[model samples]
Target chain A: MRALLIRDLRLAMRAGGGFGLGLAFFLIVVVLVPFAVGPDTSALAVIAPGILWLGALLSCLLSLDRILALDWEDGSLDLLATSPLPLEAVMGVKAVVHWLTTGVPLVLAAPVLGILLNLPSQGIIWIMLSLGLGTPALSIIGVFGAALTVGFKRGGLLLSLLVMPLYVPTLIFGAEVARRGSQGMAVETPFVMLAGITAGSLALMPIACAAVVRVNLR
Target chain B: MKQETMDTLLSVHELSVARGGLSILCDVSFDLFPGQALVLRGRNGIGKTTLLRCLAGLQPVLNGTIDVGADAIAYASHADGIKSMLSVAENLRFWAQVFGTTDIETALVAFDLVALRDRMAGTLSAGQKRRLSLARLVVSGRPIWALDEPTVSLDQASCLLFAQAVQTHLDAAGAAIIATHIDLGVNGQVLQLDPYAATSNTGVPSGFDEAFL
Candidate 1:
């Protein structure tokens, strides 16, 4: 499993490193929102949490199609399936790697992006914390989407469509925690819900994603 | 050939397979023993790939039985499974780690990939990619190798390389089931699939939900 993770990381870093694409997209979204919303400091601050969470969510989706589709295309998935490694574990590892490459980078980059959106000094850490807590669910759920559309020739749009609805809870709770913290309101409830969603997905999504991949392979 | 006294490695009894819920092959049975090679021959679209896949447990058997031991089979097909971005050595290293082996050197030598070891897989020619794919089977260290059109892109020289690899594996008491249209240049029993092709009179509906209902 460590080999698979190391190999995937190497691929992500060397192969045009679509790794940067997600973070770049996040930056662009944060920067673009300010221009679109007309440079109002209070206005940017008012919707900053929503915009940041949405940006992170979209950043994840942008790279979701890569998780399993390449392996499936080249038959690495078939070899993995036949190996001693359980399909569930293969997918579980994939989600972890995706989060490491995309989610962790986003969390670290979120605070930096927050500055451009006129986020208050106190709110920046909360944005990072909320993302750090919530993006695992994003990667896990995105694997499910990738598995579902893996056989389709043009799965990018279909993948986004299938994964968008599932991202709702994470987006809602994630934005709420960041927003409430920024406004200096009570943040504990949404924070708990965000963590709960992350934990639930981490436990269940790998099995679900593996099942879908098996059907596609069949 | 000591064929009769050898212990059977795999046995399929009254095995049937379907594709898209439609019966494609029926009443197929074959026995494979250690050091034996079974060549699955058929015209295009004749279910050879499906049969190999079914035996590999990649697809379900519609109405029959297949016996296999745990961790006994390694499957390779037209898809080379080599990552374009990784060098040939990296690709072999990944599979070596996967099959719990540290023998990338043997696989590289067996498949003549040592010269191309440091070259990225994307830059290798089609025949070279096929060689890289077959080399993975060596690291797999499984008893039974199930291959589907494994020689699809090989030239005569590469084909000989593959035949030699299979020869050595069978020499080690391993068995193989090869699904291919061309000759493997290895001595083996041929099981033609056309004789078992599903006829319209089998009376099962094309779709399983309707047929099984």
Candidate 2:
């Protein structure tokens, strides 16, 4: 499992691995928001939490296909299935690596980008926290979507369609937490809900993803 | 019968397999013991790959029983599973680590990949990449190898090298089921799959197109 994680990380860091692509996309989305919505500071601040969460979510979505597509194409997935490692562990490691490469960067970058949207002083940490908690769910769910569509030749659009609906609850609670935090309202409720969704996904998505991968391999 | 069952490493009884929801092979039974290699011979599109997939547990068996120990078999398919970005050595090392083994030197030497160990897999030629992939089986250390057309695009000498590797594997009491056309000169029983071909009458008609018939 450690080897798979290290290999995935190394692969992502390599050229054409799409490692920094999500972060770059996140940056572009944040930068473009000010341009698209005009320079109204208060207006931007009102929507900053939601926009940042959406950007992070979409950026995480963009790379979901990479989780298993390459391995499936080269037949490594089949070999991995037959290896000593359980399919569930393989799926879990993939989600963790995806989170490490894509989710963590987005979380770290959210705070810096939050400044561009005139984010409230208190909202910065909350937005970062929300993203940090929420993006793992995105990665885990994205892996499940990736596995479902790995058998398709052109699965990117299909993957987005399948994963976006699953992201709804996470997005709602995550954005709610950030919005409430920026507004200085009580955030514990939405924050707990967001963490619950993340925890639930972490516990269940790997098994579902592994089963989907097994079917796809078949 | 009792002694044979104890010695059997892999046993398939009345096995039937399908491809794209259509049964292709039926009633295929075989028993593989330690240190045995079973070569599956058939024409193209004859379900050789499908049967191998079934044996490797990559596909569901339509109807059958496959008796083998869990995690006891390693499967290699036509797709080499090589990551072009990684060096040959890195590729082998990754799989070795995956299969919980560490002796890559032996695999490298076995497949003559030591000279190109540091070279990226992408830089290797077709034959070289195939060698690296075959070397993966060596590092796998599993007792059983389920290989699907393992020796394609190889020159005679490389084929000989692969044969020698299989010989060494069998010498160490490992078993292999290889589907190939050419002779690798390995002393193993050949199981021709032509006789087990699923006839149209035996398989249930599937799909809307078949409904009209």
Candidate 3:
């Protein structure tokens, strides 16, 4: 599993397609928001949390296909299934690596993107906090979507259709935490809910994903 | 000694294979012992690949049973499990690590990938990639190999290299089952899959969804 993580990270760095594209796209979306909404600082501040959450969500979506498709296409998936490592653990590692490359960067970049939207100085940390708490859920959910469409050549549309509905709770609770915290309101409930969803998905999705991958390989 | 030798490395009894709830091969049985290889010969779409997958534990058997000793098996199929961006050495190293062994130099020489070890996998020719894929079996350290059309795009030289690699593995008390259209150019028993094909099989296909309900 450690080797799987190292190899995947190395591939992401050397391949150059997955590591920074989502970050760049996140930057573009955050930059473009000011233009679309005009230059009102207060307006930007009020919408900043929502816009940041949306950008992070879409950016996470951009790299969703990266986790499993390449391995499946190259036959690494078959080798992995047959390896000493169980398929569930393999899916778990893939999700963790995906989170490292995609989710962690999005969290680090969120505060900067938050500033670009004229977000209040106080709100920046909350956006970072919510994104950090929420992005793992995105990756776990993304792995399931990838498993469902592992066999399809063009799985993007179908993947979106399958996983988008599941993203609702995370998005709602994540946006609420950042939005409420930015306004100096009580964020305790939503923050806990967001963490709960991530914890639950982390515990369960790999098993579900492993079953799906096994079925797809069949 | 003869009685002990008859225990077999692998045994399949009246096994049936399926895909997506449809029966593909029925009542197929075979046995493989150490230092032996079984070549599965048949035309396209004859469930040869499926049978190899079943033996490797990648897919479930539809009926009957397969018995393999505690020694783990390695599977090589599905294109070249090669990552084009990583160097040839990195690719082998990854599999070696996954298989819990660090012995890569032998695999590198076995398939002639030692010279290309530093080169990016993307730059290698089709035959070279095939060589790299076959080389993974060596680094894997598994006792049994279930290979599906492993020599797909290899040149004669690479084919001989692969045959030698398999020979070395067998000589070390390993066993293998190969599904291929071309001759492995090695000594092994032949298990013809045509006899077990499902199209000629009748009696409502005999399991779970026997008749589409």
Candidate 4:
């Protein structure tokens, strides 16, 4: 499992691996919001938390197909399936690595991008916190979607279509947490809900992903 | 009979396999012993690859039984499973690590990939890539090898090298089942798949409405 993780990270970092593409997409979305919504500071501040959460969610979506599609394309998934490591472990490692490479960076970059949207002073940390907690669920769920669609040609759009609906709970709870925190409202409920979703998906989704991957391999 | 049963590495009895819901090979049976190789011979699309995949546990068998230990087999399909971004050495090391083996030196030397070890896999020629893919079998350290069309892009010399590798494996009490056309000069029994070909049309329905047919 460690070897699979290391290989995936290396693959992502290599040229044409789509390593920084998600982060760049996140940056573009954050930067474009102020222009699209006009330069009204109060208006931007009102929507900053929601916009940031949506940006992070969409960025996570951008790389979902890559989690297993590369391995599936090169037949590494088939070989890995026959290895000593179980497919469940492989899916778990893929989710962790995806979070590390894509999710962690987006979480860290959220605060910096928050400034561009005139985010309220208090909301910065909460937005970052919500994203940090929410993106794991995104990665895990996205991997499931990747596994489900790995066998199809031009699966990217279908992957997005499949994963976006699953992202709703995390997005709603996450954006709500950020929004409430920014307004100095009670945040414990939504924050806990977001964390619960992340924890639950992290626990259960890898098995589902592995099962679907086996079917796809067949 | 007792000695043969004790030495048998893999045994398939009345195995039937399908692809995309179409039965391809039926009532196929074979037994493999240590220090032996079985070459599967058939025309194209005769279900050789599907049979190998079934033996390797990559896909489920449609019918019958394949008796082999779960972790004792290693499969090498046509895809090579090579990551283009990593170097040849890196590719071998990754598999070695996954299979929990420490010796990649032998594999690199065996495949004559030591010179190309540092070069990224994407940069290698087709034959070189095929060699690297075969090297993975050595790193795998599994006793039973299930290979499908493993010599697609190899030259005469490389084919001989592969045959030698199989010979060495057999000598070391390992076994292999290969699906190939050209003879690699290795002394192995041939299993012709034509006799087991399914008589029914096992392909996808001609049209959506053909479901009734």
Candidate 5:
């Protein structure tokens, strides 16, 4: 698993369009929301959770296609598939790598991005914590979606369409928790619910990804 | 040659597979014995690769079963199965780690690719890429090796080198199921599938004959 993680990091680093591009994209999203909403701190503060959640979600989507497509094209995926390492373990490793590349970084950057959008100071913590817990589920579920669509030529668009719907519940609860916390409302219940979505997706997504990969291989 | 009994390494019974609402292969069955090699031959569009995939558990047998015995096996295809972004050595190292091996230098030397080890797999020429992929199988240390068109992009020298590797593996009582157009330089049973046999009601022509001797 460590080998797989190190290998993925090396590939992403060498691939040249990595952390910089993701950070730049996140910056654009953060900057653009203020333009779309005018310089109204009232409006931005109210919608801050939605804006942050949506920005992180879109950034997560941007990297999803690479999760398997690169490996599939170069034949590394097939070699990994045939190895004694079970597909579930491979999926687990892949999800962890995806999280490391996209999710954790986005969480660390969310506060700055959130503040830029004139978010409430109290809500900044909620945005960071919710995303920290929530983005992992997105990566895991996105992996399964990516596997299903890896074979199609125009799979990236299709992958987004398919996975976005599956992500709604997580998004809803995640944004809701952040929204409540920003308003100084009760946050534990919604936060727990968001964590449930993450935990449930974590348990289910790898198996689903493995099953989808088997179908795609066939 | 004296008749010597060998333990069955792989057993496939009445295997079938379907795709796009049509059966691609049906009732396909074969046994692989220790130290024995099997050549799967058929024209393009036939189910040769499909059978290999089924045996490797890459594709599901729509019906029936495949029981792979205790021996470890490796499957290589025309895909070369190496990550193009990674250097050849990195690719081999990843596989070695996954297969629980620490030594891959010998495998690299055997395939004559030690010099190209640092080159990105995508940058290697066709023959070099094929050799790198084969080198993986060499270091894998599995007793059963299944290859699909392993010689597709290989040059003459590398082709001969691959044959030697297979010869050595077979000499050590390993088994192989190879799908190829060219010969693998080993005396083995040939199971041929007539591309048209499934369309017509005619019995499949078993391609094994005296020349296989």
Candidate 6:
């Protein structure tokens, strides 16, 4: 398990078309939001949470296919299926690696990306906090999606279609908390709910992902 | 001295696999022993790959459990199982890490892929990719190898390389079940199947091609 984690992290870091592409995609998403919504600070502040959440959500969507596709293509998935490591541990290691390479950097950079959208300084902390708590759920859920489409030829579009609906609640609650926190409204309920969603998904998604991977690989 | 010469490393009993109302393999039984190899020979649309898939546990058995005993195993099919986007070394490193091994460089050398070590697997020619995938098994060093057409894209030299590797593996008392059309030098036990032997509920096409539904 330790080896799996270390290896996945190294692959994500060393592999081309990963972090740099993900970062560029995230930047493009953040930069494009104000153009669509207009440059009004009030509008930007009001939508900052939504924009950040949406950007985070889409960026995660772009990378979710990475979860198992590489392993599946490389035949490592078969070795893993036969190995002593239970499939659940394999999915867990994958999720942890995804979170580390994709989720952490996105969280760290959210506030800066928020600035490009003219988001208020007060909301910066909330955006970072909500994303930190929320993006792990995205990675976890994304694994299940990736697993379901792991063997399909045109799985990228299929994966998005399958997992986007599932990601709705997280997007809503994450944006709600960030928006409320930015607006100086009472933000406790939404924050707790988002955390609950994150925890629940983290607890359940890896098992689900493993099952889907088994089905797809077969 | 009673029954001390059982060569089988894998034993299958009454195995059947079905998918979505289509029965693929039925009541197929076979045994594969150490220091021996089995060739699952059949025509296209026959259950050759499906049977291999079933044995690898990639596909579930509807009616049987394969007894593989307590030994390590590796499977490589025509899927080229290596990720195309990764460099040869990165690909090897990934599998080595996953399979809990550290001798990836030596495996690459054995497969003669050391020169292409830094090249992305996606760019390699068919034979090179095939060789790289085979190298993964070298790093795995498992007791059992379930390979489906491991020579699909290999030139004569690489095929010889693969044949030598399989011989070396079996010489170490390991077992292999290869599903291929061409022979692999070693005298292999043939498990030939006639896809037309499948009997349908209607009972009219037991041996007829039109009854192949």
Best by DockQ: 3
- Tens-digit lDDT string for candidate 5 (B1-213): 122235777777777654433456667778888878899888886777777776677765556777775436798866877777799999889888878887889888889988888998879998898899899987788989998888997878888999888888888889889998998677789978663224433332245222211
User: Candidate 6, after superposition: displacement of residue B121 in Å?
Assistant: 3.1
| Better candidate by TM-score, 2 or 3 | 2
**Tens-digit lDDT track of model 3 for B67-155:** 87654689888578899999999999999998899999999998888789999999999999999888899999998898988888888
Off by over 4 Å in 1: B1-6, B201-213
- Between prediction 1 and prediction 4, the one with superior lDDT is 4
List the lowest-lDDT window of 10 residues for candidate 5 chain A.
Answer: A15-24
TM-score per model for chain B alone? 0.91, 0.92, 0.89, 0.92, 0.84, 0.84
- DockQ-derived CAPRI band for the predicted complex in model 2: medium
Clashing pairs in 4: none
Estimate, for each residue in B1-43, the C-alpha lDDT of model 2 and write its tens digit.
1223787889999988878778888899999999999999998
* Residue lDDT tens for model 1, A1-218: 98999999999999575778888999999889989999789999999989999999999999999898888888888889888888998998899889999999999998888888889878998999999999999999999999888877878999998999999999999999999998888999999999999999999988898888877887
- Residues A1-218 of candidate 4 have per-residue lDDT tens digits of 88888989998898988888889999999999998889999999999999999999999999888888889889998999999998999999999999999999999999999999989889998998899889999999999999999878889999999988999999999999999999999999999999999999989998999888877787
Q: State the displacement of the C-alpha of residue B99, model 4, in Å, after optimal TM-score superposition.
A: 0.1
Local error of candidate 5 at A166, Å? 1.4
- The CAPRI classification for model 4 reads as medium
Reference contacts recovered by each candidate, as fractions?
Answer: 0.78, 0.83, 0.83, 0.91, 0.63, 0.50
Q: If you assessed candidate 3 against the hidden native complex, which CAPRI class would it receive?
A: medium
Q: Write the per-residue lDDT of candidate 3 for residues A136-215, one digit (tens) a residue.
A: 99999999999998978889889988999999899999999999999999999999999999999999999999988987
Which runs of model 5 end up more than 4 angstroms from their true locations?
Answer: A16-20, B1-6, B14-21, B24-29, B62-64, B199-213
Better of 2 and 5 by lDDT: 2
The TM-score, computed over Cα atoms with residue i paired to residue i, of candidate 4 is 0.96
lDDT of 3 at B118: 99
